[model samples]
Target: MSITNNGISIVPSFSLEKPATVFNMSIAKGRFSFDPELAFSLEAKPWYSLFWFRYNLSPKQSKFNMNVGTHLGLNFVNIPFPNAKDSIQIQKTDRYLVLEIFPRYKFSKHLTMGVYYLRSHGLDPATLNALNFVTLYTEISQIQLSKKATLGISPQLYYLNIDGNHGYYLTSEISLSLQNFPVIIKSTINKTFETKVEGSKPFLWNIKLVYPLKGGKIKP
Candidate 1:
């Protein structure tokens, strides 16, 4: 139901049939920047399944926001074997425990800066462990495009470390939203200018179209 210009090397999610659902709610509030919220998400594909829960501290009036989250992923992967009975590939499942933290400072209504940290560890095969990612990003949101449309742009620089291999990447996300339309458009671009990691893609891009339920109810 979606398309991309290029596929990711590390996470090859090019296949269709990926479904996801999310729930988010604000729980309590005390002072500025002390709002408490909770979010839960579940996603599944033919090759993998992922679930995550996040605790967020974001206030609409505050200049600072933070999110702490945890993820559990089950990945069905195939590897090449020297000699196999049925085929030259073997299937394996990798269970991962991922921890994440993101904190951002809103400099103005249009600009924000953030750093995201993630640590992933494999539980089943201990050898497939210790993956780390750090991302530094800045975003400009809600730029007026037209009377009924808005635009958002975000650029990120990130470092990935896995199994003693390191790589650096630059990525950007662009989004367009309309006030009365039910379809939203989003695009992403990624490039790896410097890397020592294997199977890393030098450049990747994708565009997604999301249609909300309101489309069924809105009249033309």
Candidate 2:
């Protein structure tokens, strides 16, 4: 069974002149996956959401593949983007029209390396007339280890640029698939080395434990 839960981050922030707490609460409707060679999905939370469409630029599922996509995301929560080394000045939510492309090549079926790039300069949601933040995001990962029934490890590099501000993050992630249950688990820990934004985090840690719902049920 899947349940709504609370998540904690070690990173600190200031909200309304007081330091913000570490806990976040949210709900999920479960996974919505697409079949066939053309891949894409839309995940909805309680609030506003976005759409994504992925088109394979090369062969659909090849050892060496190239793909491009767009993510339609909006920021309604006015969540502040943090800076690692300095205290940030809070701002409004940024509506995004991010363009993405990724290339992946596998040394073997179980091991792979890939890089993902995204660029966006967004509009203000309320008015939909103002444009503010321009950001670029990049992620690179290598699947160095894997166990079919256990875990997979990937060391990642994250770079983010907003307007002219920039930050770099190094992260490690583990994905675990259990033996008897239809559950997927993941954990990530990241450290930010430098940040141009003031309120950014120095370290980020997150975990996800959920059963992927398929066709109104958890798939085995």
Candidate 3:
């Protein structure tokens, strides 16, 4: 789904499925510099043959950063399904209108935290009116190993209240990097403790390859 080029900073991702289903490919670039306290990222995704762009802006200061962006092309009613062949019926497509604001802070050099809140409302084609509220809490950390290796970890908690249905989830990941290769080996474990009233707990294992682009500095 996601891949990084040889030691460079480019990340490319793609997903495709079933006949007339939703398909998308995206590329993103990020930059961090020691001067001016600024960081930026740009990404583009094509869904069902329609294109969309996302841009991010953040301050490079130790304490906090702000993220603001929007979506272009295709409204809700035209959103495509990625796995329609596996489902009995296709869900109505909702137009794309997103306004998300994220604020983050670093408690120490190794520990950082953030909170996010988003409000989205659109037409579902079938339902004709769709609305939802999402809230999330996240924490990230890094531990230095040797001169060429590092370890990173992140945990995320999410609460979603959609119409009358409510759900909550917890996810975590850990990664390690070696000096010889331009790749970082990562393993992630995620579990959803509970959803609604059902105690549905699911676990997943993932191995990821990471490549450093411009700023791969490790704090001592």
Candidate 4:
């Protein structure tokens, strides 16, 4: 979800599926001043997990002066079935855990990039005993705007050597602030396709209306 307070912004978002999932929290403040800033996010997936945090100390004179932080996550899974009579039926679940550190750099006002390294493990009692591996990821984003609206695009790539699987995704979103109403309309589309993976490819399309509960500097 995305929220704004007095023109400041905070977006807490997440996604999930059968073999993969993700969680994230991001914040932006002081947009109308020379010292605008942002915060970190926590994310997790099927064979990978990550905890990353960052802060902008100053922007007017030292736009690159920023503080960085890190954390780790672990995941596992288990599945069991009963084939005999008088046996208890059970469905196994998978779990995963990872330990990770976050490194990032800011190039300019509308661009930033980051990378992550993780030590990950998984457990599924039904088909396999336990699995362990390491993974690496990189992400990039760009924000631009016309005189009346804003647009953002982000793409991420990942490598999982243990499973011999590599994946990439592209996500695009746009929002427009209407002239008369106290609302902004937003929509997004995300696509992910893999070389050896089999299953349905997920697609998402949504339109959201957002406005402040309490009035502030009304956009004219």
Candidate 5:
């Protein structure tokens, strides 16, 4: 089980403007032990909301696993500075779509790897610029660092062509599982680099305490 809430700063890759602060929360859970199970996930923030449903295709095996999923979300951003010449920069909402699939292979008890591909698109009624997105994501994970901890690092490659933006980021995560309990406390840091920004974008920090109420562990 993994969960995270992010409090971060953002400066758009294509906009040379002051940075904005945003906060987001997420919850994810694997489903029943049966084959072809469901993985449920959700995200919410003052500026964004999202839901995900994924199909888990492996059960009772450890060598390989696969998943197919969909993410649907809404994004709201308010520009801090408003200009008379520029349209009001407040409360603009966009709808987004993300479809994904990934396959993972477990080399051994401690090592696993996976590559994920996501298609992201957004539609903005205010800007009249239909939202569209495309991204490639990949990760390698260490199943256990000791008896009580796990770690993973991932890199994301993005091409939001319709929004005229491109960027990439690397995320490092660590989780500590409680002894005699099902609780997990996790933290992550993400550093982003973008084509339009002069330097590295602001770093993001996320913390999540996850508890699975019911369900078997999902395949990666």
Candidate 6:
């Protein structure tokens, strides 16, 4: 569960991965997932779900590593009628398939840099749109405050293109956590530097309280 400034997001997720293995799989809902660009509403209500399967392509000891993944998504969208006079909103269901690739270089134990790319293809042309998203990011981790408490920060620059409309944005997240704690605190900020897309917000911010219910560890 995550309690954000906007609302509460209840995300129930399942993960299947083996240590030292090259393959991983996960499924979750209730949040915006870029892998398939499953857009959830800003409110707490969830209307989309995604399943992702990934495989690592680099050796275990490599400083630079690459991962390739795919996302299968089912989304429910509220599509307004073409007539502007009609005050009713119509709901429609759609599916999406996306391809993802990310490559990261670990500069040190505390620093890492990466680039992520995702391309989403809509299954229903009548209701959904294709998307291309790319992110360049750097992470700083393991800033210790105590033996068990740590801080992590990630800064990202991203580009999004949907149906020929495009935008450039900057985003970041700061997280604080304790080693044995079930709860983590995170704050995210996003700003649109430039955009030609409609309905894009110039700035957005949120604070999230996240809880882990199962086997999880904060590497931090």
Query: Against the true structure, candidate 6 has what lDDT?
Result: 0.67
Per-residue accuracy of model 6 over 1-220 as CA lDDT, tens digit each: 4555442111101011111111112333322222322224445334566677667787768899888878777766667877868777876778888788889999998999999998888988674377878899799999999999999999889888878988898888899999888888987777889888665667766677776546333353
Ordered list by lDDT, greatest first: 6, 1, 5, 2, 3, 4
Clashing residue pairs in candidate 5 are 120-133, 121-133, 122-131, 122-132, 123-131
Q: Distance from true position, residue 189, model 4, in Å? A: 4.7
Q: Report clashes for each candidate as comma-separated counts.
A: 0, 7, 5, 18, 5, 0
**Residue range with the least summed lDDT across 10 consecutive positions in model 5:** 32-41
Residue 20, candidate 3: alpha-carbon lDDT: 19
Which runs in model 2 stand beyond 4 Å of their true positions? 1-48, 78-94, 125-148, 215-220
The residue-by-residue lDDT of candidate 1 on 1-220, one tens digit each, is 2223332322321222232322222223242222222211123223545566667677567789898877687666667876667668766778888788889999999999999998889898544578888889799999998899999999888898888888888888898999988777877777887887666767767666655442122234
Per-residue error for 102 in candidate 6, Å, reads: 0.2
TM-score of each: 0.72, 0.61, 0.55, 0.42, 0.57, 0.74
How do these models rank on TM-score, best leading?
6, 1, 2, 5, 3, 4
Q: Judged by lDDT, which candidate is best?
A: 6
Q: Write the per-residue lDDT of candidate 4 for residues 54-149, one digit (tens) a residue.
A: 444445565344333323332222224557555544533344443444445566655666654444455444322322222232223333354555
lDDT of 5 by residue, 1-220 (tens): 4344443322122221222223333345554211221122343324445566677787647578887877666665666455557565555667766666777777766566666666666554554243333334445556567775665654444443334544555555565665567776766565665443334345666676766556344477
Pairs that clash in candidate 3: 9-213, 75-95, 76-93, 76-94, 76-95
CA lDDT, candidate 3, residue 175: 80
lDDT of each candidate versus the true structure = 0.66, 0.49, 0.46, 0.38, 0.51, 0.67
Query: Candidate 2 lDDT (Cα, whole model)?
Result: 0.49
Work out candidate 4's RMSD over C-alphas. 10.6
> What is candidate 2's TM-score against the reference?
0.61
lDDT of 3 by residue, 131-179 (tens): 3434354555457688878888877676655455556666566788777
Worst 10 residues of 2 by lDDT: 10-19
